[model samples]
Target: MVSRTGLYPGTFDPLTNGHLDIISRALKLVDTLYIGVAINRDKGPLFSLEQRVEMVEAETKALSDGSNSVIKVVPFDTLLMSFAEELKADIIIRGLRAVADFEYEFQMVGMNSFLNDEIETVFLMADPHHQAIASKLVKEIARLKGDITSFVPADVASRLNEKFGN
Candidate 1:
């Protein structure tokens, strides 16, 4: 039987609990999951690629245990569909937070389907508590010396604090 693998791609500038929630839920639908960190040059990410990868690796280490053990955190600089094709991922997992997100994700799903007909996209609704949490907002709040402990992981919070010299 073919191994079922899913690709969850995102910038993940600083991994957050909402992201963790999505990752945890995505694992249940596929035998293996690749959390792809997008290396988008245009975004001017606050964290370096290496730092983002390390943070994701550290955060997901606990999920790499047990019989199913097939979680991978990797960096992808190419198009998401190309990365999914290269990794032989059968599905692309995305998290939907609100109606605005739905509209954008809808267009993306259509484009992704057009790029690779065989691969499917799966959308998971964010948990109610996480519905309003976004990485951009988290970063802004953190930059302004606001409390971001509730939005991201402790390690990420520490990193943000250190980055902002808080």
Candidate 2:
């Protein structure tokens, strides 16, 4: 409760239900949450930046009904911590699902802390049901013509299928 604002940045090629869980949990811990949609061309995102932003907006519409419905979606070029600073956010909310993610996030947290000593990073473990769902895995499964209906929201799954020609 110390920090009222948080920045939650991610590729969100197409927002999934797992991402929804993280956003929902982070909402409880902060007054405002900035869901940053970073457009990294090097990543070769499945969806365009505008499409990703639209999906993120749709997925977060429920938050608009909350008392602190202060979630905003924005595009970022790079440097996540720099984006946080620009948003004047005091905390960065990260979603961690498995042990493998810990290593990468840990290093990033340390680097972000070094960049902005006053900014804090908080990691939220994904819900047990969604611990295995990730954007990469979802894409891989779609490419293989596997069912990922459970891994993402309905709209996202449809978009993924269409994008991958499944």
lDDT winner: 1
Q: Put down candidate 1 lDDT per residue, 1-166, tens digits, no spaces.
A: 7679999999998888889889988888899999999989899999999999999999988876642748999999998999999999999999999999999999999999899999999999999999888999999999999999999999999999999999
| lDDT string, candidate 2, 1-166, tens digits | 3548899999997677889999998998888889999899999998999999999998788765664648899999969878888999988999999999999999998888889889999999999999988899899999999999998888888988998888
Model 2 poorest ten-residue lDDT run: 61-70
Q: Model 1, stretches more than 4 Å misplaced?
A: none
The global Cα lDDT (0 to 1) of model 2 is 0.89
Which stretches of candidate 2 lie above 4 Å from their native place? 1-3
Residue clash pairs of candidate 2: none
